[model samples]
Target: MTVFSVNHVTTYAYAEPVRLGEHRMMLRPRDSNDQRLLEASLAIDPPPKTLRWIHDVFDNCVAVATFSGETRELRVENRITLEHTPFEGDEFLLDDSARFYPFAYDAEETPDLARSIERHSPDPSGELDRWVRHFLHPGRPTETGELLMTLNYAIKEGFYYERRVEKGTQSALETLARRRGSCRDFATLMMEAARALGFAARFVSGYLYVPDCDGENRHLGGGSTHAWLQIYLPGSGWVEFDPTNGIVGNRDLIRVAVAREARQAIPLYGSYFADNATASTMDVEVRVRQSPSCELPSAPHRNL
Candidate 1:
């Protein structure tokens, strides 16, 4: 078992004082069978007038903060400690029916997963479909797990990792054309590609932990929030894949929220009302490290 502490700070600096509106944040890590949240706290400068927590359609915890006064700078800090049990890609066993490509999902589960399987981006040219087909050889059997892993690694090796501070994810076609993009862009591409292959794929937004020992092998998209995708497989359920780092399973990926599309999983967003007081700059800092002490009990704990 590994315990980790994550500190995330986001600040928005304006040209002058402005009336801040309600801000929604998704900084808390999700508690699952393999991962447990130990403790969490959030601090905001010029304290919010009211703060409330609610679960969205996807059952992700979201914090909504409303402010009354005005300030030139808006800052939000989140700290959390979690216990994670790593799972490797090879550990999962797929059902016999889904062990190979060109499989079908259970009839009952198809309804719920249909939206995820449907491609969100338009692929009129069938470019993305042709790209995904490369993993499957004609007139021969293809191992499902191997195909997915190869695709994940292909993105990491084939494309350049570009850090884009701008909002929104690029369409899969855009990433394919450039052969380079941010972590989210890579995730979006993988998600769309998997969907085209008749798989239920979702976008995951969270923090990634990189140990000091990694040194030269440190993962990319670490100093800030990271993005990845999960594909649902029979027997194994939803399996994670980080194309940006060629990571499989949960490993060092700490998930905060999951969405059918990237736009639905913004970490922090809000607007400020001001006249002629345009925003000047925005900065984000994230740090994820292994904790020195483990406080979780040996017995398995249920998610709260």
Candidate 2:
């Protein structure tokens, strides 16, 4: 088990003072068998009149903040410490029934995964279908794990990784045609491709831990929030695939939220009201570093 500390800060500056609306924040990390939250704290500038926490439809923890006054600048900072157990790609063991491609999910599990398995984008030209089919051989059973790993690595090697400051992700088709996109775009493409192959997939938003070893950085899309996708396997459950970095499992990925669409898992979003004022600038910084030890304080913040 490795301990990690994450710090995320977002600042929005306006040309003039504006009344802020209720802001929804999805900055808290999920506690799972592989990940355990140890401590968490959140601080906002121009404090909100009220702040409350609730779980969304997907059971992701969200913070709702309502402001009563106006401010020219709004800043949100979140800090968290957790223990993460990495899962290597080769460690994934598929059930015998699901070891090969072209397999169907259990009838009992189909209902809940139906929505995820349904393709969301319209591929009138069948470009994505053709692209995803290249990984399989005609009239031959393909190893499911190998197929997925190859596809994941293909994205990283085939597409150009560009950093975009945009707010939303581009369509899978767009990314394919351009042959270049941000991490989220790659994730969307992978998710849609998996869905087309009759697999349940979801978008994951989180932070990436880029370790500095021997004065060298080891990962991409670090120093900011990252995006990836998860495919549901029978015995393996939801297996993570980060096409952006060609990572097959969780590794240094720290998940904050999961959703069918990227927009639903935005880390922070809100609106401001002002007749003449407009958002002048928006800045975000994320840091994920390994802690020296796994020690904890006497009392931990369980609600975070």
Candidate 3:
């Protein structure tokens, strides 16, 4: 049976009350089998100064926001419908014998560690060859899937996902030095390493439900948000990688939207008339719910 209900609310009364907005995403008939019915609505008081387009890496729900004058308020709401499936430890098709998206050994990659990253590293992206290499190295996992798996585990093991106040988000190097970071840092390292290897990769942002076992003290915990990575492959398409839990997707995860980077999937973002890009403050809220009749079969399988 679907358990408790969760509602998230965040308010940022800017120094001065500015115009704002409340955009919404109307859940459509999703193409996934695990999802039954999904619906969501967003409202703004006094309406917004302006409503702009906002998207996330997962491209799940298009968040809406409105601006007033000086104190722009940002409100976000997330509603998800899920059909629980028993934890059966589904089958995993891990491929690693060969490269999916191959490219000629080119100098354009990482002139120093193309091979280190491509073969022994993450994806083909040069952005984090050195950083990712510190975690995943030659022949760690024989399969490409295993390579990613190694990285995921490495991140969870090496970093502490505690909420803190830091200036200028850290880079791959900085993250490696600190051995800690948010989803942004984790995804960046993964993307940079993958791209260095020559495979196309991108950053993704969206919502991920923390396991009940962890309660509210989890990474991307309730009201906090979630982050993961996606690597482009040849025959298999894009694959999701979660370093937080060292696990990929089963039914526990929801695939929302995708984009080149997290900025593209901000849920809601827009430039107004002037250069006042201070972004005084921004807030987001999300909720995932499972219905009563939609019981999670004791046995979780595709039945395929």
Indicate whether candidate 2 or candidate 3 has the larger lDDT: 2
On residues 147-218, what C-alpha lDDT tens digit does candidate 3 reach at each position? 666777788787876554332345665666677787767766666656655556655554555544424434
TM-score of 3: 0.65
Overall local distance difference test of candidate 3: 0.49
**Residue range 1-304, candidate 1, lDDT tens digits:** 7888899999999998899988999988788999999999999998999999999999999999999977999889999999988863325678899988989999999999999999999999899999999999799998898889899989999999999999889999999999999999999999999999999999999998765562454578988999999999998899889999988877788999999999999999998998884856889999988877423222221110
The segments of candidate 3 whose C-alpha lies over 4 angstroms from its true place after superposition are 1-8, 20-37, 49-76, 82-90, 94-127, 134-141, 164-169, 213-220, 270-304
| Residue pairs in collision within model 1 | none
Query: How many residue pairs collide in each prediction?
Result: 0, 0, 42
Model 2 regions lying over 4 Å from their true place? 88-90, 293-304
**Model 3 steric clash total:** 42
After superposition, which runs of candidate 1 have C-alpha atoms over 4 Å from their true positions? 88-90, 293-304
Residue range 1-304, candidate 2, lDDT tens digits: 7899999999999998899999999999989998999999999999999999999999999999999878999999999999998763335667899989989999999999998999999999899999999999789888898888888989999999999987788999999999999999999999999988989999999999887655666677988899999999998899889999888777788999999989999999998899884756899999888878333222211100
Score each candidate by Cα lDDT.
0.89, 0.89, 0.49
Scanning candidate 3 in windows of ten residues, the lowest lDDT window is 295-304
RMSD to true structure for each model, in Å: 4.4, 5.6, 7.1
